[model samples]
Structure formats: structure tokens, C-alpha cells
Target: MKCKTIVGLFLMSTLAVFSQNASVVSPNKKISVELRNSANTQVGGWYLKVNYSNDGKISEVFQQITLGLDRADQSFSTALKYLKTSKPNLINEHYSVVHGKRVQCTNSANEVVVSFENQGKSKLNLIIRAYNDGVAFRYEFPEKGGTFVVNDELTTYCVADSTKRWLEKFNPANEGLYTSSKDGNLQQDWGYPALFNTPDKGCWYLIHEADLDKNYCGTKLSNVAEKSKYKLTFPDQWNGRGQGEVKPTITLPWKSPWRVVIIGSLSDIVESTLVDDVSTPSIISKTDWIKPGIASWNYWSSNHGTKDFKKVCEFADLAASMGWPYTLLDWEWDTMGNGGKLEDALKYIHSLGLKPLMWYNSGGNHTWVSSTPKDRMLTHENRVEEFTKLKKLGVAGVKIDFFESEKQSMIQYYLDILEDAAKFDMMVYFHGCLVPRGWARTYPHLMTYEGVRGAEWYNNGPEFTTTAPEHNTILPFTRNVVGAMDYTPVTFTNSQFPHITSYGHELALSVVFESGIQHMADRPEGYQDLPDAAKTFLKEVPNAWDNTKLLDGYPGKDVIIARSKGNAWYIGGISAERFPKNKTLSFNFLPENVKYKLTLISDGEHDKKLVTEYMVVEKSSVVKVRLLGRGGFVACLKPIL
Candidate 1:
């Protein structure tokens, strides 16, 4: 009976191992997770291991094969065998150690370390943050980093297939993975899941997909000089992706351990978890140097000619008179197909008090400019030269248009432009681009990017009648969390336009949306004809703010945001579809014992006209308010002594 029981137990254990789809291979020693696609194909995998002291303290956690390699070579086959071997020597040279307590491992080439701490519940909190334009990850440690408590790593590994194609086609090199086939059987390269590694205490290593071309890759090390903070080092020969016509695959397989360190008690880990749920990336800088201002001509007005220069100047003069700092000399002014001269137009724009920003294409291809002069077009090598010319032309910034979509190569191309622009003190605003993922902080010169379905669409038709109202409310929670949005606000009034939401809602958007360089999206004639009180509010409204506070409302219903600059606060409130007749707003964050003079813009109580009312109020324990129907409100408050 005892012999039979032993045989039965062994059989049960084998089944248990097979059933575990994703789990820690060995608690406190190794951690791993496997992922399958919707088609049930094993597409990706992740693994982590830790070595620790006898007193329940971690010495190191080795990352063997966090993200599996593509089926490209014999080296990958050998790495798979090494993973199963679980032998100490099979582990790669990349391993991270924290003092003598804990260690981590990975094979990634680029790494960023933000902050880490310990939470008392036998868990250590590890935050693997990013300084570039990518996502971040967090890990939980058990018993002073003795055991790695992993949740799910599969979500982080899956790269959108479309993003890979975007990278290849838009990359300046023009090398990619996709091939045209009507039958849809094309040879495409799959993106590898990103990996992190720390061999010793020198620096953190990050390994990720270089671009759309999966053949070539590189790694970057962070925080090499210091033990506590981040310093970066790059490989001497490690040229990034798309460097060669026929991309060369790395000969060596990644077989290293990714590591993170914790200095304090377990309580630090618990505290870090509070922010773990706030998963979206945050902006590092607000693009203050770019100066939040207004632009004159937009996509619709780009066709206006030299004959209309006087009219354009009149608009620019009005924008400046209304306290706007900059105006745009959009397309057609370039003399691309026409005989217009850029140098001549720039001279006239500078004569006005407003700064001039011109439009350019990423690939130097515009609708009208069938054949661009070789010198004007942007190539990788000559990008610096073109930027220098624009700077010499006395342009404050350049609007790079028609990126089309979010592709890996296009994304990298944008980053390259931003890096170059910084060298010349030039600012960039991207059009037809993807949502921001905190790149503005790394490169402060990246003024703005257009990913939102903004005011420009209003010109296409009345499609906004179906979605615009809800889109405004949903974006703040989703896109705004990532970074600043260039949602061009304040379009012409509904009375004149007679399109989507009310004119009051448009006025409210000026306050609701956040942009370093905000656009007064309507024609100057739209607001110029309104009463002095309405015109004064638009003229005095500032685009940038020191701080922002969310007062009330949800995704699609309503939202109130208060922005502050010095002693003044600007409150903007918006409601979708219909305005609340008797909305009561609470001001709990206002300073106590201070009196404020408020300038309010709201819909008239009896008349249908939108009016600006002035009132005085004190910041007490709680302040109350009311709102009009389809009506929005904007109030400027000055603190009185």
C-alpha cells in the first residue's frame, strides 16, 4: 500500500506542473509567467529569480529569459535549453545587487530606476520607472526581498502588431517587416517583449525592440556611475535599430538576471503600492519654454495667399492686441508650388508684436509642394541644416504635420526630431501623431502633439454632432493622464456655426483643456465682435498655469477644474449635452480666511445670451454655486488681503 501511494503522488505532481499556465517557477528563487494569444499560440514568456541571505533577506534575483526571443537563430534554441537547465552558470552576466541584501536580473539594454521602498507586510515595493517615452512597471517583494511576489507580467509584454508596422514604414531608413500580399500571407517580424537587467551595481540595463525592423537591436544602461541614482552608459558598437539595410541579428542570446534594491523596511513596499494602481505614465515637464500662445491660420486657412497677407496681418494684429504672443504662417507661405517667398513673409510677421511659427512636413511632402527643393526637405543627415535655416528665418517653432499614425519607426523619427530641435532651441508641435507617453519631460522642447480628434474635424462635416460632447469628457481621464493634450479649444459660436454643442460649452473648453501653447481655435472675427466683457475675458485668459485641481464630476457627465497662477485662480466647468440648471459646486481646496473677487462667465438666467458677471465672495469652509443649461462657466478669482 505505501509503494502504490508514492507512485500515485508522483503522477499527481506532474499533472499539477502542466496545469500551471503562469506562475513562479520556484518561490524566492525563480519567477516565471507564460502567455498565449487569442488563437492559443504560446506567443510570449517572462521569468525572474532571486538569491537571498539565510535571514530572509534577498541577495539577488536573476532574470533568465524574461521575454523569449523570436525564432530567428540557433542562439535562441540554445538559450531555451539553458532556461530549462536552471544551472547557475547558464544565467547571463546581467544581474543587479542592492548593497548585500537583494539582487535582480534581466537582459534588457535600456533601463530606468525611479524610486523603491519596503512595505511592512513582508513585501518589498520595486518601481522600475522610465525617463523616456515608454511604460513603467512595479514589483512586490516578500520578506525583505527574500521572495519575489509576482502578479501578472503578460500585459506588459504584448506589443500592438499595428505599432510595429508603423515603425517600419515611417522610419527614416524606410526599412520594415511587412510585405504586400493580396492573399495576406506575408512574412512579418514579431516584436520582442522588453527586458530589464542588472548584472552588478554599475547600472541598470534595458533591452527593447529598436524599431519596426526586428532584425537589429541595442541596449542602454542607466545610472552607471552612481549606486543610488540613475546614470546611463551605451555600448560602443551597439548602433540602434534600422542602422543597416539588411538588419543583423544579435549573435549572443540574453541570459541575465534583472535586479532591484530596497534599503528600508517592508512598510515602504506597501506605501509604493498605493501609487501602483495609478498605472498611466505622467508628464515630466509642462513645455513652459515653448510659451503657451495662440496661432492664426489653421488647416482650413492654409490656402490663403500673398494677396491675403494684409488680412492675415490684420488677424495677427488682433491676436496680439488680445494678448496672444504668437501667430502662425501656415502652409502655402512656403512658396512650395506657388511663387511665394518665405523670407519675405517672415519679415512682415516679425514687424507685428507676435512671434511667427511656420509649418513643415516630417517627410517634406505637402499636398501643394509636388517637388520640394532638396535643401528644404528633411533627411536624417540634413535635419540639423534645415532646422538652422528655420531658426535663421526667425521662426519661434515648427509644426511638423502628417505623421499619419503611430508606428514604431515614426515614433522614433519624432523622438529624433525633438532631440535635434533641442540642440537649436527650437520647439516642435506634432500633427497626426499618437497620444503622448511622457516624452515631453525627457525633451522639454516637444511643445505639443495632436492625437485627439480635435477642432479640425469640425470642418470636415457634422460628424462631431454624434461624438464631440462625450469625447471632451472622456479624454481628461484617459489621454490627459498620460500628458498634455493639444485639443484646440474655443471654436466659433453655435449661433453662427449652428453645429454641435452650445457656444457656452465652447467657451468652457478654453478652461477645461490643458495645453502649454493653447490655441484660440476660432477665427478672430468670431470673438472679436462679442461685447467688451466677453472679449476682455478671452484676451486676459492665460494658457499656462502653475497648478491644477479637479473639483467635481465624472467621465461623460460634468467636470470642474481650477487652475492657479500666483495669487489668481481660473475655474472652468463644463457639462455634456445639457447644462445643469442648478448645479452646486464645492470649493474645499480654496484657502481659508481669504476673500476673493470673482469674474464669472455663465449663461444668462432669463435671456438666452451668455454673459459675464462680476461678484465678490470669501473662501469659507465650503462655497456653493449654480450652473445654466448646456451652459458652462469660467471664473477668474483674485485673492484680496
Candidate 2:
């Protein structure tokens, strides 16, 4: 048979089998579902897919299945238990559909609850709930999962409350732009606006998983420009199961997990009730041996080849004087198999009152550390001995480099390294690796990872100018939401020349970006001659924080972030270009009835040749202020009380 005919036959067979076990109990609410047995041969496995209206306003979708043995065991176990027992105990059996209009739906196994109620002229509540193991909170619409012709308009709904507000509140014109559908042809605002509010109402943590086939997961939505497709992936640490494959061999039948989207306006009630029962707050591991503080050399630095014992000691001394705690000796320090002694470098770094960190490749082709080593080199026995030797040499941390391909085998390899490193009390920094997915919480000594596009590219060439802005903006919302990023910050104003942001903007990033060990990404000489004001700002920035708040803005246009370490508050804001009008910043999270001393760096007046030298210090009762064009600001605030 032809390919199209084969696919049509397959889908027809699958749909017919699905229809036998499925039905739409609520057609007006657009809630539909199907369920089958684990051994069902027609579709190759037992499966269920539900597309429903959530809380009357949002439309959502969910899919689950038990296919082959490997995936079937786990998927079937969870699905069966949820359908049979867990869900029935949790759902509110009787609830009001609207004022003076009470409705009751039968409670049954594998049933998903869908309800919609008109709230006001422009607002509605779309709710979907499964008493069993599956559940999701989302914002859905009419044309969901369907193709749209060009120039079509779409309406989006949200709960009208304070706890959860849409991104449109910040930029009214951009709201609902992310949800529109688009044809194969390019056009702007093809997607819709989406946000997720959880019981954990602090920062938005997003997980995106792309399969080896490059199939993107997550909620399908449009972008403001309406030219692209966007999807969010479920958080899977093992990236499914087995190496290079999502285990269980199940096709589309398995419901991976709910793709959660929260309308912030109704965050409090929704987060408390709608989030999946399986989702929980992260649990961070204990780091008994690893110490947290500033570090000297990062993965990419200029002073590598020329530094001898004397120069190394001088740099260590400078770092010690600055109240920084550690120093690093990166790649090439070891001669691989030629026998370089790590003791000599460790001794000198320690002599300067700074802890020492060394670099090693996780699994590479180098003569010293090859993935497929000849003789005893590739075995775990030999690697453990090498790690033991490094530990004796006083190495506090090991920077593991170059596990470039994120395959299942590589994931296992890194997990093994983290386990072995823990045995020797050595901390780890992963380079050329994927973003952290709460790994730091599981292995605290895994200080940071280099999945982000960081400062190293800036020194290389022109690509830095184009990519840095969006990368910086999206990271906090996506990657950093889960854990720390080892993005080396603070390249001096002079080093970046004309392409860089002003010194103040650079200075502010130390607080804006979240990392465990924030490296001073510039050379020692870069900050040596900076003004005293800028110098003081750099010196006092902290690497860790007790809390962080995204005050306003989005990925590309602009972003403002505030973090607190102890009593001090460090705020940083950046813009893509000089805006024609001023933007007002709000500080609603600050403690009320208290005065603060604000020291700010912004655009200089006409006379100041140094564009970054502008400073403002004032006592402020109101936490709102207007920032100038193309202008960014960094401020350090200490409470006057």
C-alpha cells in the first residue's frame, strides 16, 4: 500500500478501537476522552487522550498509554492506580457551575471532569480534573491543535484576580498574541499568550524536552510575531528511559505528564487546586564538602598559557584580598598521560589562602582522558584511582568538560561521575553539558553547568552581539527557574568595547543572573582601573540569594530582576535599546513602612564622558521610578530603619 493509504488505514483502525472505549460526556465544554486495556492490539497498546475545557476559560489536552513491556509496566501501573483509586478520593464530587445553578457529574473510573461557566462578558472559567493520577491546569481555546488560515484572530481567557495575572498586563498589545494559529506561511502573532501559576507562586519554572528526533514537547502555542510554533516539554531527568530512546516503545498512547499552564490572576485558587498531584517542590541535596564563594579562573579565560607559579600566586593573592574564596586551574594544566603533577599547582593556590579547583574532561578523545581508553584507562577502577589521587592533592572541585552530545549514555556517564566525585569530597562544574534540571538540588556539589550561551562567545567574534540579548532574557524564565547556571559574569567595560552594555549594566548582571559561583569573567587588569564607585559595586555583589523576584518585562525587549542576600537588595534592569519613552519600575515585594537608601547607576548627563559613571543616592518612600531611554539601571538598597 502507498504511505498515505497506510497511515490512513492505521489512524482509522486506531480511531475505531478508541471510539469503542471513549465518548464526549460534555460536548459543549469540548471535553472528550478514550480509554482501553493494556493488551489492546488494535492501537498496539491501551491508551487515553483527553482534550477538555479547564475552569470554563482555558482549553487543555492530555495523553497517556501503556505500549510495550518496558514502558507498559510503569505507565500501566500509574494509569491503572490513578483511574481505580487515587483520583476518586480527591475530586470535589459536587460543585456549582454558576450562581444558583448547581450541577453534578457522575464519578467513575478513568473519567476526566470538564466544566465551563460564564464569569463576565469577556471572561470564563475552563476547568478539567481527573480524580485519578492525571491532572493539568491550562489556558485553551477553540482552534486548539488545528491548523489556521492566515490573518485569523483568536481570543484568550484568564481568571480576573491578583494572584495570577497574564503577561499581557505588562504589555497589553502583546497579550493573546502567543496563542493564535498559523498556516505554513510566515506571519506575525501566530501563537497565543500562556502562563503557569503553581502553589509555589515565586518564580516560573519551565521544562522543555526535545526528543532525539527534534520533536518539541510542551503546550502548543503561537508567538507574538505569529510566525513560529512553541511547545513545552515535561520534566524527565533521565529524558524518558534507556539510552537514546523513550523506553516502553509506546507510540502516542502514553500520557507523558500534564503540560501545566496557570492563569496568574487566579493563581491562588488554581495553584492550590489545579496543579498535578504528582508535582512537588524541589528538594536540594546537602553539600558537606563543597564550599560556596567567589572563584578565580572559569572555563574560558585569557591568562591560561602564560601564568607561571609567580603570576598564579599574584592572581590568587588579589582574589583573596577582594574577599573572594577560591581559584581555578583550567584545561591543559595536566599533561594527560605525560605525567603533570597536580600537587604543585594545588600547593601554590592553597598557599595564597584560596581553595584550588582543577579541570578534567568527562569523557573525551584526549590522550590524558579518552572515553574509549586503551588497556585500563576506560574502566571505572582506573578512573576512581585517578580521582583519589586528585583528592589527596587538595583539589576542592573538579571542572568536568566536554560531554557535548546529550544522549542516554552520556547522561548515565555524568551521573556516575557525580556519584564518584561525591566519594572523594570533590565539587563539580559541568561544561559543554545540557542545562540543569534540578540536578543541583539532587547533587549539591554540582556547582554550575554551562548549558547557557555565556561570556566565552563574546571574546570569540560577531555572533556574540546577536545572541547575547535574547539568551540572557529567556534563561531566567526557562533554565534558571529550575537550578543555578554557571554563566561567568562581569566582563569589564573596556574589554567588550562598543558592542557591550554600559559598565553599570554589566555590574548589575552579577545580581540579575543566578549562579552558585559567579566568576569575574574579565581579566585582572580589566577592573584594576575602574572608578571607585564601580569597583565598590563589583566587590560587594553576592553569588547566592535568599529570594529572587522578576519585577517586570520579557525575554528580548527588556527585563528587570531583583535578588536578596541577607539584608541587602540588589536590583538590575536592562533594555534592548534606548527607548523613546521612560519605563516605570515597581517594587511591590519590598517590606512596607520602611525607608531605603538607594544607590543607582544609570545614563550619564551630557558632561560625563564616562557613560557608566552616572550615580543616584536618595532616601525613597515610594518604590517606583522612571528609567531613561536605552538606559538600564543597577541599584544597591539598604533599609534606613
Sequence-dependent TM-score of model 1: 0.60
lDDT tens digits, residue span 380-433, model 2 = 675688778877777788777655444334555666777777777877878766
* Quality of model 1 by C-alpha lDDT: 0.45
Off by over 4 Å in 2: 1-85, 88-288, 298-311, 335-342, 364-379, 493-498, 578-581, 605-620, 623-631
List residue ranges in candidate 1 displaced over 4 A. 1-135, 138-289, 298-307, 336-341, 364-377, 494-497, 605-608, 621-629
Please report, in order, the local distance difference test score of every candidate based on alpha carbons.
0.45, 0.46
Candidate 1 lDDT, tens digit per residue, 431-468? Answer: 65544544554454666666666766666556665567
TM-score of each: 0.60, 0.61
**Candidate 1 weakest ten by summed lDDT:** 159-168
Report the lDDT of model 1 for residue 600: 76
lDDT value for model 2:
0.46
